[model samples]
Target: MYRVQTSLTLLLSLATAIAGSVVHHDDSFQPDHILRVTAQNYTEACTTRYSVLVNGTSPGPELRLTEGQVSWIRVYNDMKDDNTTIHWHGLTAFTAPFSDGTPAASQWPIPAGHFFDYEVKPGIGTAGTYFYHSHVGFQAVTAKGPLIVDSNDDPPFGYHEERTIMLSDFFNETDKKIIDGLTSSPFKWSGETSAILVNGQSRQRTNSTGSCQLASICIEPGLSYRLRFIGATALSFLSLSIESHDLSIIEADGHYTKPLNTSFLQIGSGQRYSVLLKAKSEAVLKRAGKRQFYIQITTLERPKTLTNYAVLHYSSGTPADLTTVPLSPPLPTAKTVQGWLDHKLECLHPDHAFPTLNEVTRRIIIDVHQNVSDHVIWLQNGYDWVQSFPQSPYLVDIYTGRLDTGGLYQRAISQGHGFDNITRTFPARIGEVLEIVWQNRGTFTNGGLDVHPFHAHGRHFYDIGGGDGEYNATSNEERLKSSRPIQRDTSMLYRYREKTTPLAPSGWRAWRVRVTEAGVWMFHCHVLQHMVMGMQTVFIFGDRNDVMAQSDPVDAGYLTYGGSAYGNTTHSPVVRQYFD
Candidate 1:
C-alpha cells in the first residue's frame, strides 16, 4: 500500500509523506454547525426559479470534519413548501444509524418549517472526500455542497494547499419542472443538461463557452495543491482534465488509494476524489508566459456533450495569456470506462486490503432494469422501493414489532414482479460478510450509454471486480487473483457496448462487504430520476433491536416528522415528493 510521492522536490520527502499512511482514530473533532434550509429564487443558465438552498447558498457551505469525531449539525427547514432531509453523503454514520437521513428507511423527512439535528460520526479511519445533499427529491440538484473529512494526522501525501472542484450539471428548466416530467403519467424523460458547472460557475448556454466565467482556484508556484473533486450532478457522468497537468489520484470516497496517474478523470454522480496537482515553478511559468491553466470538464456517456472550464491561477507571474491554454477534450468511449474499472485502485491502508476469504455468509445477484408496463419504472431486485400505505419508517416500525422479517419478505413476494427470493429489504446478521452483485440488462450499446453509479449509505464496500455481461463466480475467481479490491462508497457499473446481444446484460459490478454496522442502509442508483422511478432498496444489517439501540430517540424531530411513531398526534406538513 505504497502511496505515490509527489515528484516535486519542494514538497515533503517520501519518508515524511508516507509516515501518515496508517490512519489512526481521532476523537477530538467536535463541530457544532447550523444549516438553515430555505427555498429562494436562483438564476442559473438564464433561468430564475425557486431552488433549495442551505444556509442561503445554492451549493451550501463546505463542512469541515475530523476523523472519529462526532459532530452535530442542526438543520432548520425554512422552506415554506417542500420537505427536506440532509443525507451526509459518504459519511458512514457508523455510531447512529438514524443519522443516515434517508426517508422512511432511516427516518422521516424534516417537514417544512421544522428542524432536525443530524449527528455525523465518521469512523476513526473513515475520513476523506464526501458531500451532503438534500435526500428528499429534486432538491439535490442545487442543494448540495462539498464535505471534507480530514484524517487525525497529516494526509499520506504532501500538499501545500487544497481546493474543491465540485462539478455539477445545470438545466435551463427548474427542478420542479424536471421532477414533474419524470413523474408524469406518460413519463416524459428529463432531457440532457443545458450547461456544465464547475463550482457553480458557468455562463449561459450559447454557441461558444470561450467567454464563460469559469470557476477559479489560486495557486502558488512550486507547491502541491490537493484538488478534491466531487461529482454532484443529477444525471451527468463527467470526464475532467487539466491543461498540461496529469492528475495523481490519492483518495476516493474517503478511502486512501495508491495514487492513480491519469490525464483524464471520470467521475460518476455521488462519487468524490482527492487528486494531487503540483503547480509549476514561477520560473517555468515565466518562461512559458502562462500563469493560468484550464481545468476542463466535459459531460460523458450520453449523446450530446457539454464542456466547462475552471482556471488554475498562479500567485506570482506575468498575467497568463489565457487564450493560449489549449483544450483538446478527449473523446470518451466504452474502452475508457472499461480501463477504469479494470485498473485496480489499491487501498493505501495496509489493514484494508482485499480479503482472501473462501466464502461469504450471503451472496446476492440483483438484475437492474428500466421497464415500462402500465408506466415507466425502474426496478431493483424486482421490487418497487415504495412501500404500500400505512407506510412508516422501517427503523421505527421494525423496532416496534410492526414489521417482521417474514411479513416483509412475504409482502415483497406478493407485490414484486421478479426475484421473489429477494425482497426490497435484504436482511443480514451483524458481522456477516456479504457479497452483492449488480447485473444491468436490456440496454442497447448503439446509442444508449446509461451508466449507473451505485451509492451505498451507512457504509462503504470493497469493490472486488466488474465486467461486461452476466456475472460468473467461477470467472470472477480469476479476477480475485489479480484484483486489489478498493473500498469505496460509490462505484459506477459501466454499460457494455454489445450491439450483437441486444437482450444480454450490459455489465456487472460486485461489492464484498462485511456487515458491521447495524442499520437499514440504502443502496441505490445515483441518478436522481432513476431513484425517483424506484431504483432503490435497503440492506438491513443486524436486527431491529440492534438498530433501535443505536438510533436516535423515538421522539427526535426527524423521527416524528412523517414517521408513524407520532403521525396520528403530530402536525407536520405532508410531503410526497420522492417516489417512496
Candidate 2:
C-alpha cells in the first residue's frame, strides 16, 4: 500500500511539471500558483465575522495570465468542515470539462483537507477580464477574485494604466446562517445589503460619529486608465457612476468591442466590463486646486434606496474626510437611474460583431419561475435540480453510460419526472448551432420582476437580442434578421415594470451558441441564491465516445485519485464497467 501511494505521488508531480511546461503561442506565459482555502475571521460591515476564504483574503489573489497560455492552479481545501470548489466564471473549459469547477456537474466537490489541480490553456481569442469564485453554497459571496488575460494582439485603444475594480455586497451574518434562512421553510430572503465593498474594503459606519476607513484609488491628471469593472456581488445589481466622468466601455466579459460611451453603467452579478477613463486634464486639475470624486454604487430596486461610496483621489491634491466629499451632484435618484436604464436597454453590448449563422439548428425555450411547496424554490422549465450525493457525479455517469438505463436518465429525456426529482439535460449533436430563448416569469407572490444574470459554463454565446414580453418566434426572426449581436458568457435578463398595473409581461433574452465542444456544460442563473434554490440545467454535447476519447489524462488522474490511467472508481458502476 505504501509503495503504491508513493508511486502515485511521483506521477502527480511529473504531470504537474508537464502541464506547466506546455506553451501554445510565442507571447504566452505559464502562470502556476497554489491557493489554500481556510477559515478566517475578518471584519467587514463594522463587524467581525467568520468566513471561508482563499489564501487568507476575501477577494483572494489576482491571477494574471497572457492569452494563449496554459494555466495550472492548485487549490488546497483546508476549511475545517466544508468541501469547496472554485469556478472560473465566464471561462469556457473547452476540452477540459472536468476542470470547470462545478460541483456534481464537472466534478465532485474537493473534500476538506484535499486538493485539486485545474489546468486549462486559454488559446487565442480568449483574452478579457474574468473572475473566479467558490461554486458551493454561499461561499462565493465572499470567496472570489479576478482572472485577467492580457492580449497578445495589440488593442486599438491606448491606456497609460489599468485597474481591476471588484464590487460585492456584504452581510453581517455568517454564510451558514444566511443559507439556513434563505432555504428555510418560511423562505426568508436575505434583507437589504448591510454594506457594499469596493475591491473588498469599504467604510462601514458604526455609529452616528462615523467610524471606518474608505478604499481609495489614486489617479494622476492627464493619464488614461483602463478600469476593469467586475460585478462579484452575491445578490445586488449595481448602477455605478464616477463623479464628473464619462466611461467609454471597450470590453465585455473578455471580448473587446467598439467603444460605447455612457454617463453611468449597469453591472449585474457575475458580469464584467472594461471601460477606459481619461483622467481629468492637468489644466482643469490645477485650476480646481484640490479635488476628489465619489464613486457611487446604488441598488436598482425600489422601496428603500441603498448606496455605497468609494473615493477617487487625485494624487496632486488632498481632500477632506470621506463624509465631507461635496455632494455637488447629489447621488442619482431611482427615477434618474431608471431613465439611464431605459436609454441603454436597446444596446447593452452594442459593439460586438454578429455571428453569420446560415441557420439555427436547434431552438430551446426555457422559462424561469418560482414554486412554493415545502419551501420557496426557483425552477427552470418547471424543474428544480437537486444534486444527488453518494452516487457518481453527472459527468462520470453520463460519460460511462451507467445511468443511461437508469430511471433518472429516462425521465430526463422524456421530461416525465416530478419537479423534485427532475434532472434537466438538453442533448445536442456536435457542430450544431443552438438558439436558446431564456424567459423570466416573475415570482408568484409579489409579481415583482427580478433581473437574473444567466451564465453558461463551457462556451460564450452570441447575444442576439432581448425584450420585455412573451417570446414570439415570428417577431424574434424579424429582429434577428435586422440586428447584429455581441458575444458574451454572462448577460442580464432585464425585467420591466407596469406603469398603471401591477402585472407586467415576462422578459426574454436570446443567445446562439455553436456546440463545438463535446462535454456536459451547465447553463444557469448566476445569482447564488437562485442557483441554490435550483435554476440550472445542462447541455450534453456530442456522444460519450467523443468526450471520453478527448479527456485529459492529468485531469482524469485528479478525479480518480491518481489510481489508474483510466481513473475508474468502485462507487461509479458505469465508470468501473467501462474501464475495468
Candidate 3:
C-alpha cells in the first residue's frame, strides 16, 4: 500500500510540473505581449507615493489584440505585501476560472515577485472599448488599462477610423494613508480629488501634446471619425458637449444604440460612448467647396482646478462655411422599453407584480451609503471586503435575513469587507425580468449620488427613471414617463446636485433597472473612487433556457488545476460564485 501511494504521489507531482511548464511554452503564448506591472513606492513632489503593487508604472499599458485571437498575458507582482490578480473587464472565456483574478474566488493571488500567466482566448467576437484592472483590494489604484480588440473584418458599427480615450483622476497620496484614515474614523468627508488625467498624463497644463485643449481636433470639411470615450473618474458625473459641433452617438457600453444626434450628452464613471462626428464648416467649402467642423469634448462638472480638456483642431485651407443643425427630438417609445420597464417594477415587487410586466420573477436592492471623514474617506454599503470570507450565491430562492447581520449574507459569502466596502452578490432568474432599485441614503454631509454608469453582461434593458429620492418634476416629464431611452448594457444615473452635503439629489439619484438576461453580471458605480468605497454588486441569471438545468457546473474558471478554492467564496455552499 505504501509503495502504491508513493508511486501515485510522484506521478501527480510530475504531471503538475509538466502542466505548469507547458502552459508557458504553448505556440499561442506571447510573453512579449504580456502587460508587465510594477507597483513600487516613489517620492512625487516630496510626498511618498505608493502606486499600488503593479507589474509596471502608470496603470500598466494599453493591450491591442484581434478577435478570436489566443494570447498569453503574464502578470508579475513586485509588492512586498498584499496579493493581486487582474480582471479582463467584459471579456468572455471558457477555462476562465483560472484567470478570473478575484482573490479566493477564481484563483489564488500572485504572491510578491511571482508571475502568473493568463491564457486568454479573446471572446470569438469581442471588438470594442474594454478595460482590465486589478481585482486585489483597491489594486485598481495601480492596475487599469485599455484592452483594445481590433476587427476591421466586420465592424459592429460601420466606422472608418476609431480613437480610444480613457479618463482618470489622480491622487498623490498613498493608499495606506488613505485607508488608515478612513478606518480610524469612518465618519468624515474624504473626497479629496484634485486632478484629472486623459490616458495616464495629467494634462493639467499642456506640454507638447496639442489635444489637451477642448478644441484641438481638426477635420477636413467632410470626413467622419469614430471616437470611443470612457469616463473613468473616481467621483464625478461627466456632462459632455461640443462648443459648436454636433455629435451622433452610435453606441453605448460597446453595444450599438439607435443613433441620436445632439450637441450635448452625459457620461458617468465606468461608462463608454462611441460617437460619429461629421465635419461641415464653410471654411472647408471655400478651400474644397465644402463645410469643415472640429470635434470638441468638455465636461459639465468643471473641476475646481481644471486642465487637459479634450479638443479637436480643424483648419480650413480656404474659407469654409459651417452650418448649424437643430437638435433632434428625444427617441419615441419602443416596445423593448415599455416591456423592460414593466418587468423591472414587477421584479421589485414580486408578490404584487406589475400588471403591465411581461416577465418578472425577482428583485434586488443595492443601497449605497457614504462615509465622510478627513483622512480615510469613502462609501460603505455594508462593511469592508475580506478575501477569506465566503460570499453568498447571487441566485437563491429565498434569503434568511437572520444570516444577514452586520454584512453577513448567504448570497455574498462575505459582504463589504475591503477597500470599497461594496457587496458583490445578487440573485436573479434568467429572462425573469429582474428589477434593481438603487437607494442612496445620504449618511454623510458631503454624500450625494455620483452618477453610476450601470452595465450588464449578456443583455440590456430599458431605463425607467432615476430621481433624487423622488422623480424630477422640473425636467422633461414626458421623456421620463414615456421611457427616457431604450439603452442597452449602459445607462447613467444623472447628477442632480453639486452641494457639498449629501442632500443634493444630483439629478435622478434613484434608478430602476429591468434584468433580461440569464448569466452572472456586475453592476457598479462608474466613479472609480466610489467603487473603491464598496459601490459594486453581482447578480446571477440562472440558465433559464435549460429549465431542468439546476446544477450549474461550478464555473471552473473559479478554480485552478492545483485543486485549490477560488470564486471568492469563503462561505458554506459558496457565496462568491456570482461575482467571480
Best by lDDT: 1
Tens digits of per-residue lDDT for model 1, 162-245: 998888877766778887787788778788887777777765334353454556778888999899999999888888888778
Model 3, span 225-306: residue lDDT tens: 7877776555544445554567777756545555667555555556677788776555645665323333322334433523
Clashes by residue pair, model 2? 128-254
Q: Compared to the true structure, candidate 1 yields what TM-score?
A: 0.84
Ranking by lDDT: 1, 2, 3
lDDT of 2 at 506: 74
**lDDT of the candidates, in the order given:** 0.70, 0.69, 0.47
TM-scores, one per candidate: 0.84, 0.84, 0.64
lDDT of 1: 0.70
Any runs in candidate 2 off by more than 4 Å, and if so which? 1-31, 204-211, 317-329, 334-358, 388-391, 405-422, 498-505, 552-580
Best by TM-score: 1
**What TM-score does candidate 3 reach?**
0.64
Global local distance difference test of model 3: 0.47
**lDDT (Cα, tens digit) per residue for candidate 2, span 130-149:** 99898888899888899898
In lDDT terms, how accurate is model 2?
0.69
